[model samples]
Target: MSQIPPPRRRRALGCGIAATAVALVGIVPTAIVFVLASAMDPNYGWLLFITLPIAVFFGSVALVLGVIGIAFALTDRGGYAWPIVGIALGAAQLIPAAALLTG
Candidate 1:
């Protein structure tokens, strides 16, 4: 008799999705604000205050979670697209943060 196949696991997909969402939250709004404000004023240096906390604190979380989630996804045969996106976004957040420090 033929046996049924096991169900595909998605145990870590939620983690991946959450990582992506958090990364987005840390960066997208800040980007939108700068993009909008740059058109009106040449100086918006104070916004670095907002970027610093999110980048230093939450960006690291998203990066670590994304890596862990991707590993879990691979082992569990879950989709990894979100985790990859999350990692990229998390890493991207560091650029502006480093710029803030130096410039």
Candidate 2:
């Protein structure tokens, strides 16, 4: 018989999933906006100022959530797959945001 995961494990998994979704929600739109902005005239560059800050906010939230999810999973002996995925996605979002912010 398969045993059900504990509540903590389930919560951790949910957190991981949420983190990944948040990261994607931030990254994808910002990427599209950046691409469009780049293709357009320099006058549209102001769009980056708006989009980049939003992306950074979401990325930061995702990173924190992913870290929290990972910690919960580790402590509860929950499976690590989702949390790792969350961390990867969160990192992916952050990298571009960092580059945009610094560049």
Candidate 3:
């Protein structure tokens, strides 16, 4: 006799909440910093132009992740992948900014 497969587990998207919060909190600071940097150094400001989009994208992803996570959790389904995506996009935003500072 063939055995039946087990049901898939539903994981939570913890990163989603954190990412949304981070984005909400980070937006102003980032904008301010970007403006200041631009005022001080146009080249650095340009980096902000590039990095800001990533941050916004990630922030939006995070919001979506949070919503999807909640919805899936309520429906008893798995939908935690969004958090990972949020984190990835968030990091994408940070990478260039960090690199600018480091390099």
Which candidate, 2 or 3, has the higher lDDT? 2
Q: Can you give the TM-score per candidate against the true fold?
A: 0.77, 0.73, 0.39
Better of 2 and 3 by TM-score: 2
* lDDT tens per residue, model 1, 23-96: 88888767766876688665765775776676666677889889988999989987888888888888888776
Q: Per-residue CA lDDT of candidate 3, range 5-99, in tens? A: 98765545554556556555546556776787867866566565655665666566565666656665566655655555555555555665667
Worst 10 residues of 1 by lDDT: 40-49
For model 2, which pairs clash?
A: none
Model 3 residue 5 CA deviation (Å) reads: 14
Candidate 3 stretches greater than 4 Å from native:
1-8, 14-43, 77-103
Per-residue lDDT for 48 in model 2? 66
* Candidate 3: 10-residue stretch with minimal lDDT: 83-92
Q: Write the per-residue lDDT of candidate 2 for residues 50-74, one digit (tens) a residue.
A: 7777777887888888888888888
As a whole number from 0 to 100, the lDDT of residue 54 in candidate 3 is 58
Strongest candidate by TM-score: 1
